[model samples]
Target: MNSMKALSVIFIFFLSLVTFSSGDLIEDVCGTSSDFKVCIDALRADPKRCSTDKKGLVRILLQQCSTKANSIYNEVASLLEQAKEHVLIQCLQICKENYDNAIDDATSAIKYFDANDFLAARTSTVAIASAPDTCEETFNEPPVRISPIKSKDDDFMNFIGLTMRDLIEDVCRTSSDFKVCIDALRADPKSSSADKKGLVHILLQQCLAKAKSIYNEIVSLLEQAKEHVLIQCLQVCKENYDSSIDDAETAIKDFDANDFPGAMSAVSDVVSAPDTCEETFNESVKISPIKSKDDDFMNFINLTASLINQFGN
Candidate 1:
């Protein structure tokens, strides 16, 4: 028994050493200069400040910057937001340069996160990896006209189809505010007309199918959240009204001008819808008075989502 206890003690010591070492690695690589040193040092100075485990590194990094982290995180976020791998890689490199020792880890993360390829896959099956060096491939630039919309590429159509599936699954089935998510897609004026219309038609059909799930929770349990969903939908509708109307108008113009393909593409934009439900569902949780922060927010969301599925039907 004594030998077993001794072995256990040694094992624990080894584990603690590894844990502390990982924390050090995270801290050293996350920041530059003595400023970061101070933040990490605080963990040693006050046991209370440092987490007993190493999962707290991100929290510490955020705490160290406080308000500035928001901007930094935003920059990181925008890379994904606009689906700009080049800019994202630049930002990640900058992050590592600022925190040198973590360069390998950061690089590894960047290498693994093929955001360009991933987002591209979302829209089409041919994983057209974004050539980071291509000067014209920034997020603001139009999506590369890979092929005519009617091209016989099964993968491309599958890509758009899968994305629509996700938008329907993640958003349309969850809340009534799906219109908001669709608005983001519409902002890109260059998307093919058929693709846009097909995407929206899929979502609307899925929502109607899921409407039965939220029948009970629709009227009560989470009215604030319900209203928030409606508000998001209304807001998106308000913003897209002009654009959608314009797309329809443009489609007519293209058709009259005998631009069959262009008219179809234009028509797609006017008809396409994206799911905007998640944002409102999330926001409602933030302002909810009945539930404490620990009150199983995901479960609440699921419940409210069920309600939303039935709301408009």
Candidate 2:
């Protein structure tokens, strides 16, 4: 035990020597001092000194500086673990300074990106606002000294957009005419439709799409933060849904008040029309039993007989 204790002391001494000699690798890139207040302030004041391209340079600095900063932090932490009372305080101070400096570098990158409003240009306008904190919460780790917000935003939006497109196609397999009519009015960037009847069906489908959008946003928020945010978001969606249903009811009421027969005639036509289901199921054995010509003829005669019997009664 005594020999082991002596060996541990020698090892720590050697480690301290190494840490002290590795004076300032991070400082060389950032500056001569551990305090980055002056360095960060100067960069903001006249950012050209940092690099030629303001946005690109800020990103690069954050990326490169983070690795060096982490090394410094680890060294300081290790030194603190083996320090005497006198050196422990100094080590703690240095650790705090380095950590803050790294965070500031990250903050600078975020500010530069925000100033350019890059999020709007890309599809990540929403994710950029929420991801930094969300990523930290999910990892149960402190926010990284460097965050690739722009890159992450791009990946997230691309994946969601593709998924939404696939969902839309799978759910709505109407005729080309119907699809065209709905696409024309759906504010979708794809195709257009000319059939009036198809537009109504498409509108209802769009309501579902809107509900899904809000649900996704709520889920993403809940994943990142408290359940309260998700609940509030859902409440907003419910209110919006109610308002839309009320508007639709009012529109229908007005139409009926002005022309009840006209409204009924349109509804009757839709009821009698050969629906998409009939077109798609035409050859299936299940439907042929009812739609065959022999069955139709028998049904016609039976209907006439029933009418004659009714008059006699």
Candidate 3:
């Protein structure tokens, strides 16, 4: 642990610049990774991300994978010891051997990484990533039985893959549109790299921007709103947007204070602005000039919320 801590500090100094905050560093690193959400989730899940640098991310990921690998190795061993069926025993034998190599490789990989041996670290990590494949295939051979440790294999793979691709594919899968969410995150490099808290920060900024823009537009519309009904509706909308902006600010403060529920409540408040605006127009002319814009902004807010739900996991 002491060695790891020392290595983490060295990683921060050497891999990340002093000018950037942890949030900035996370955005920059995740921005460059093949999987943004995976990287950010992995980093932001650990409170240490706020203090670490790029290589520190690698250290953290490697350590996580290594620990999981050890546990999986033990799990495989336990299964091997308990196997009664000849076929299952054979499969477990193969899995045990695979885990043996995997554990060794993981150990070497961390030592190599901490020592700044990039080539070796890459080699070991690649090995670790592929280590479970043989175990999986062994069970699928001949009569084709399922691997007892299939879930464990997959779990380790996801952790290891966080450095490369997304581990938490389910985050998007459960969403309204997985591809849309993925594209949205990937489209913005900083956003792609953001952890849960960081993502909320970005999403709220968008909400705030949308609110202010819509508010200004509402004010402008008031200038041309000749009909009494239209004028009244516009006034209501302006006030609604004003309330939303305040709530959004409150959400930001609550989020920073570690009050997640409070932040989400504030986020929920943002909905009333758009909903009430649309309803006000519907009650009168049944058509709002700002309906389309409000709808679009609302979609953005929902997407942000969906993403927040995923990252919160």
Highest-scoring model, lDDT: 3
Counting only residues 3 or more apart in sequence or on different chains, how many pairs clash (N, Cα, C under 3 Å) in candidate 2? Answer: 3
Tell me the spans in candidate 1 whose CA falls farther than 4 Å from its real position.
Answer: 1-229, 274-313
- Tens digits of per-residue lDDT, candidate 3, 1-313, equal 2211121122222233334554578767656555566666776777877777677766776676666677778888898788899999888888888888887887887898888886566557556655566788788799788888887665555444433224123344555566655655544434322344554576667778889999999999999889888899999999999999998888778777777777778888898899999999988865798999889877777766665555445
TM-score, model 1 to reference? 0.18
User: Candidate 2 at 234: error in angstroms?
Assistant: 83
Return the TM-score for candidate 2, rounded to 2 decimals: 0.18
**Local accuracy of candidate 1 as per-residue lDDT tens digits, 1-313:** 1111111111112112234453355354324322344434543443444443442432232232222223333443444455445654554443323323222322332233234223332332211111111212332245432211112122222322322334343544444445544443333322211233333433333332222222222323444445654545435433443454455556555544656566556545543322222333355543323223113322322333333223223
lDDT of 2 by residue, 1-313 (tens): 1111111111111112223224332233234222244334434444444443333433333333333334444554565566665434443544445444544543553454446543321222122222322332233333322222224322332322321332233333432333533243446411121122333334433333433443354345435644553344434433443443343343334333544334333332222212321333343322321134223322322322222222223
* Candidates arranged by lDDT, highest first: 3, 2, 1
Best TM-score among the predictions, by candidate number: 3
The lDDT for every candidate, in the order shown, is: 0.33, 0.34, 0.68
Clashing pairs in 2: 180-192, 180-193, 181-193
Model 3 TM-score on a 0 to 1 scale = 0.46
